[model samples]
Each structure stands twice: as structure tokens, then as C-alpha cells.
Target: IHWHMNISNQINYVAADEKRQIIPYIHVKDMQGRVTEYFAKDSPLTPDQIAKAPRHRMDCVDCHNRPTHIYVPPDLAVDQSLLARRLDATLPFLKQQAVTALTGKYETGDEAMQGIAKTISEFYESKYPEIGKTKQLEIRNAVDELQRIYRSTTFPEMKLDWKTHPNNIGHFYFNGCFRCHDGQHVSPEGKVVRKDCDICHTVLGQQEGAVSMASISGTTFQHPVDLGDLSAVNCSDCHTGGTGP
Candidate 1:
């Protein structure tokens, strides 16, 4: 099981102040009442204050979003305790959501839940190489029910909250490539060219398993360097003070 944000476009309700305004609050507690974070909208904390905050804070789906695969870790890679609570909560919601995705309504949610249960059973049965004779009939029955549902409806549109720009706190608290080099806006206006493979280098063994990181021969670099005997036109060769012609 995994933990991800279950909300979107979050408007925090903090009526503790005089004005009844919903601040952009991130719910930092899970079902087990663990503090995953302590983010507040207007009450920005200083470095010292932030340092004093707790390490673990829990949040809903608005914070833990899935991008293709479950890329985020730490806060998202759920354990047994959290998973059980989430499963109990998610199963009912999943039924409603799946039905909505299919028929655009929740009326069929009960039936959808049954179908989901059967599908899960079938999936587990098929996961093994071979089932015992005793298990085969049960697996068959479960799978047959799931298959009926498959013909009955389609899947939902998978949505994700992704990083549109750099520097904003990540969609998740995990390692991601977009955390740094998410090329959106730049200062030097095209000077930091959006790079492609062909712009500076070429991929030789694209289909092959192993490929070289070194520059290919004959691709003369714009900034060339010369040594006594050998000549290097590629970057890093002379930049690192290597002998080149």
C-alpha cells in the first residue's frame, strides 16, 4: 500500500482568526494521528521556526499525487498501519469513483465495489505460476465475476498534480528530476538553451543496452583547444587543462 494526497485545489479552513477565511492549509495528520507536516498559508515560518517543526507530518491526496508510477517515497511509501487505514477508507471511495469514471454516477458504486473485489481476487490468483486443484475453481469463479465487470465498464481518467515550474514545493516529498531542472522560465533568455541530444551530442546505441557517455569523434566542438601533438575540439578536454592539439 502507498500514501498519496487525496485532495485537490485545497482551501484551508482556519476559523481561529477574527476574519472567517480559509487559509491554504495542508492537513498534516493521518488516520493514526501522526503529524506529517505543518504548512500554513499566511503564517510563514522562519528558518528557526521551521527547524523546530516535527519531521513527520501526514496529509491527504492533495499532497501525495501519483505521476504514472508512484515516484515519491518517504511520506508516500506507506507501511502496514497506514495502509490498513487507507484501504478501509479508499475501498468505498474507489467504488464510487470508478463508477463515476464509467457511468458518470455513483448509483452503480455497490456493484462496482463487488466487481473490484472479484478483480483483486483474480489478480492475486493469476499472480502465481500455477494454482493447486483446490484453489483453481475458486480462482475461476472470482475471475469470471471480475471479467463480467470488465465488459460492464471502463476505467477512469488518471489525473495527476505535477510540477509546472521549478522552486515550488514538490507535488510530493520525494526525489524527482523536476525538483531541479524543470525548465519553465529562465533568466538569460534562451542563453540557457533547452537542450536535446542532437544539440550537443548524439546517441549511438539507443536500442542497445550499453552506450558511451564520451563525445563521439569528428564532432568538432565550436570551442577547440590545441596541444603540442593532439588537438581536442570537444568540451572538458581542454577545459580540464588536458593536452590537446
Candidate 2:
């Protein structure tokens, strides 16, 4: 069980005068009855104040509302397609081009499909004419796959995509844990739900390497890019999809 917007052990509602309309404090209870809570450092309310607000237990739908209707981000789709050889990664800027084509602002789904097909075809035709001619079949396959990706992930009529319905599984590209673990939810006693990374998961050899006991026992999280201690900042602050921050 996971919980957000924890007011307190007793009170659940507090005055909404803070800058952020909703400051969520992340809470998780495991099968063994172990419960852990994280507070955002930016919370306006003090520990005493937060101790008065009400807390609601979170359900599956709170985080995974789109379980069946999952929408993949364009970048992820491109990567998967490349991995599966549907899109030729050898093409100079295949990833960049594919993402650009898929993420285009089309008024309708048909327009988007056409735009994607045209974009891929035109890019290969103009940039790599020889390879384009030789690998026309591959190019055609790529175009079909890219169009398929767009169709599965986006709904122009509903304005739905990864951005519209931010995934909550992790904190890289969307709101997710940050929606509650931002360290803003405070208690009346002035204590906040600390957003310590280790509170949720232990770092166990993150890179592509063999695992060791030392790493399993205790390993600090290493940010991909050097950002001195993300104690207060959130991932969505910089990583808004596409190329990472």
C-alpha cells in the first residue's frame, strides 16, 4: 500500500495556502507490515500542522490508472524499435529522427500517421540516398513500425500522451513518486516526510555489471549526470522526456 497527501495520524485536511496546491508525502506499507514515509523538504506546514491533517490510504488506481491503456513515450518506442531491428540504428540520426517524427504536433491521428511516414521516408531519401535506395525494404518496415508506435501511444483527439497522463511508476520523466515524495507535505510538529532515496530502494550495482554483497548491503545512488545531492530538487524539474537531462 502506498499513500500520498498524508496530513497526520489523526487529522487529514489542512488549510490550502501553500504555493503548491497539493504537496504529497509518500508512504508505503509492505507485506510484512513494515511502513515507511517520506516527506518533501519544501513542505509549508510544520510537523505539528501536518500531524493534524487527514491521511488517505492509496489504492492501485491511484498510481496505475492506465495499466491497460498504457502509452509509451516516443523515445522509448524508438529505442525498443531499434533494439528489435525494426528501426535501423545504423542510420546516422535514426533515434533523433524517429523521435522527432513521432512527436510532431498533428491535429489528428491520420495526419500524424501521414506525417510520420513522410518524415521517415523524406529523411532517408534526402540524407542517405544510396542507403535509402539499397535499404528501401528496411525503410518501409521502419515507417510502418513508427506509425504503429504512434498509433499505440498517442490519441490526438483526446490530447493524450505521456505528458497528458504522466506515468507514476518512477520519477524520471513524469510526476510519479514526486507527486507525493517531493518533501513538501509537512506535519504540525514541523517535521516533514523526508525524500531520501534510500527510503524506498537500496542501490544494488545499478550499471551493467555483476552484483556484489557490498553493493547489496549499502550503496549510494549515483545520478547519471553529476547533480550535487538532489535533496530538494525533483527529477521532472529537468527530465521532461526525449534526451535525458
TM-score of decoy 1? 0.21
Candidate 2 per-residue lDDT over residues 1-245, each given as its tens digit? 24242323221233323322255354445445555555556656676666776555555544666686777888887888888888777777878888888888999999998998899889989989998899888888888898999888888998887677656677767756666556665544665655788888787766635654357586888776788978767877786556545
- Tens digits of per-residue lDDT, candidate 1, 79-141, equal 221354432222222333222222222234455455555544444445542442445554444
Which ranges in model 1 have alpha carbons more than 4 Å from their true place? 1-108, 124-181, 188-245
Q: Which sections of candidate 2 miss by over 4 Å? A: 1-21, 24-55, 207-214, 243-245
Any idea how many clashes model 2 has? 31
- Tell me how far the alpha carbon of residue 186 in candidate 1 is from the true structure, in angstroms, after superposition: 1.8
Candidate lDDT values, in order: 0.31, 0.70
- Candidate 2's displacement at residue 146, Å, is 0.7
Q: Compute each candidate's TM-score over C-alphas.
A: 0.21, 0.72
